[model samples]
Target: MESDNKQPCQTALYEEEETLARLTKTANFQGASGINQQSLNFRKDQMCDSPAERILKQLHNKQLLIVNPKRRNGIILYKRYHAEFAGPGSAVGVSLDTDCQKILPVGNLDLISPESADDRQRAYLIRRQWVRLTLQITENPEPIGRAQKIIEQFEGFFDSATIAKLPDEAFSLLVGVLPHTVAKVRGKR
Candidate 1:
């Protein structure tokens, strides 16, 4: 009967609306920037498991992730007051230093385990990559030295145009330098 068909159609439309509302809620919770503010808001006791906790657990497990160059799989590990960019060719989830921070994978990170790496990639991993190198250089005694050295190190790896594209705030956060100091150093180049 027509009534039976109409009832089914109404049920289908209602289900579709519920599904859409759930998706929208998830999207709103995650946000456009990719950081899960919802997870950040919850205390350890209140939340059983979260995406952020999983990332920290992976870091603690010493699982290394290489940023996929083709996708520009960039990640920003940030605390409430600081942030650092881990770009392509950089390793993540390797250092325990990220324990207190949140990992925001900017785009879909094509992460592969080290066991999957070939000989060339293995050799590349042997060298001190971006995050490690940044931490080391930022230990400089003088503030100006910290800023200049980070800029210099980045220049050695990335071309001027590429380096120019990165935000000054990221560079400054890694080295404990002011954003203006990074600008001054970049201007000198």
Candidate 2:
């Protein structure tokens, strides 16, 4: 009689251990439809309000879909990254801080330099609130006029800072302080 009870007890304990191990080992999950190291891919316009458990269940059952729509000529109402992984992305060697090269996910897509159509699209993704990103303006920009002109092309798409060359040692502009702060800092000089 005791042996019969022991079997169920052991099974329950085993289940508990498995759950604990999974939670402790990783912050988020990796679904079959997501990148090899992250969660399932999300579209550019899909609202992301699902609970973690629901997302995990979707991943487990392979019910997620990754959408890569054909690019439009201009920014639009809908745009997002390829996926949303709810975990500390340390596995991808992420969160690196450096001045040479920085790769931030502008909607789960990698952005090196804001020079191509794809890069522009990624910027649009951020503009549409489809994804989150952190970009570094490392290159010493050209003369103020030309550089501002270049950056202007990307205006209304994303918020970024302009590094002023006032020789005041104020090399960094506040994030999202594009036109306003730029004028103020220049006025200070």
Candidate 3:
């Protein structure tokens, strides 16, 4: 009886993986531009929507697509994937860089696999530091002033010993406020 159940379980797992692969592939193909009506229709067909409109409605709710209101036909001008922390066959992770590339802790959070507690602690600290930096940037209005303030606040968060021990990337991220704040600064240079 156990052996009989195993086959069905394996089949279900295989199907689920295949579906995920398809979804990921479709999502990546979209790029930053937009998907056409044909692609949207294909997705709707695959999902078995009785009408194309309903599928589009579902996609809008999921935030996978955005419709242009000015357009006559309610044209979808952009498609965005739901932010996923985990890739295929992987677990949830956190984005650490400005570009949003290079996810850390690439595996199931519950399992922890080979990552140590120290590594997890460092990631947590980085996340906290990012939140702090973001809040400081938002609260301040002047660009140069905000940048200087953020730098000072970041420095104040660490002691001389800890500052010397901090990673280059962490420092870069902490001090990377200038570029982000410049947009809000008055007058073009």
Candidate 4:
């Protein structure tokens, strides 16, 4: 009799775990959609009045939502969890220029560089290149083919460039930044 009762309880626990896993996956998928603020607000209204806050609370106790002061009306934005694993907004890494030699670190790249004009310019150019390339690659119907062509065309762009001229310290910094950027740019619908 006790065994029979325990069987049902175990089944219930398994079901609960499955449900939680599905919910997490759905939340991650929706979050990664990169919906604009208005769309996000609409989604929140349709789904939950405070979706981000709710998700954050679920992920971490004592978590809070904060507003973006830059906007005219402060918009409530949840603090990103693990960016790589979280949502699209919480992506990691930096953007690089056409040469694939320069880097513009995301989130905190500015803090890593010196306050020199040349350094700032280099960083800005690198970021611009990254954005340009990202747009070009994503907008293409055959991104892989296009990217290959572009890469081949600009193969030697970085040959003359030296690491000393770059604002970053390590070549791995450039390497590390690509996966997140690719994920962000290519993971979209």
* Tens digits of per-residue lDDT for model 2, 21-113: 464344354332333332222321122332222222222443211212221111111112212211111111122111112122222121122
Model 3 over residues 4-24: C-alpha lDDT tens digits? 322211221334347645665
| TM-score for candidate 3, residues paired by index | 0.25
lDDT of 1 by residue, 1-189 (tens): 223222211221333346545555766676625544554344223234444455555556665655544443455666557666666655566553345366655444444444455733652563346557777887787878998887786676556765676677777877888888888877843
Using all chains and alpha carbons, the TM-scores for the candidates as numbered come to 0.46, 0.19, 0.25, 0.23
Look at candidate 2 and tell me the lDDT of residue 17: 45
Q: What are the runs in model 1 whose C-alpha is more than 4 Å off?
A: 1-64, 69-76, 85-90, 94-132
The alpha-carbon lDDT assigned to residue 109 of candidate 1 equals 43
Indicate the worst ten consecutive residues by lDDT in candidate 1: 3-12
What tens digits encode model 4's per-residue C-alpha lDDT throughout 1-189?
223222211221333346555655666788735435464445444344233233333224321111111111111121222011111112112221111212222111101212355654554444445445545544556534443433332333332232123222122122223333323333321
Candidate structures ordered by TM-score, highest first: 1, 3, 4, 2
Ranking of candidates on lDDT, top first: 1, 3, 4, 2
Report the C-alpha displacement of residue 183, candidate 2, in angstroms: 7.1
The C-alpha lDDT values of all candidates are 0.57, 0.27, 0.34, 0.30
Please give the RMSD of candidate 4 to the true structure.
20.3
Please tell me which predicted candidate would have the highest TM-score against the true structure. Answer: 1
Off by over 4 Å in 2: 1-142, 159-188
In candidate 3, the residue pairs with backbone N, CA or C atoms under 3 Å apart (3 or more residues apart, or in different chains) clash, namely none
Q: Best-fitting candidate, measured by lDDT?
A: 1
Each model's backbone clash number: 0, 5, 0, 0
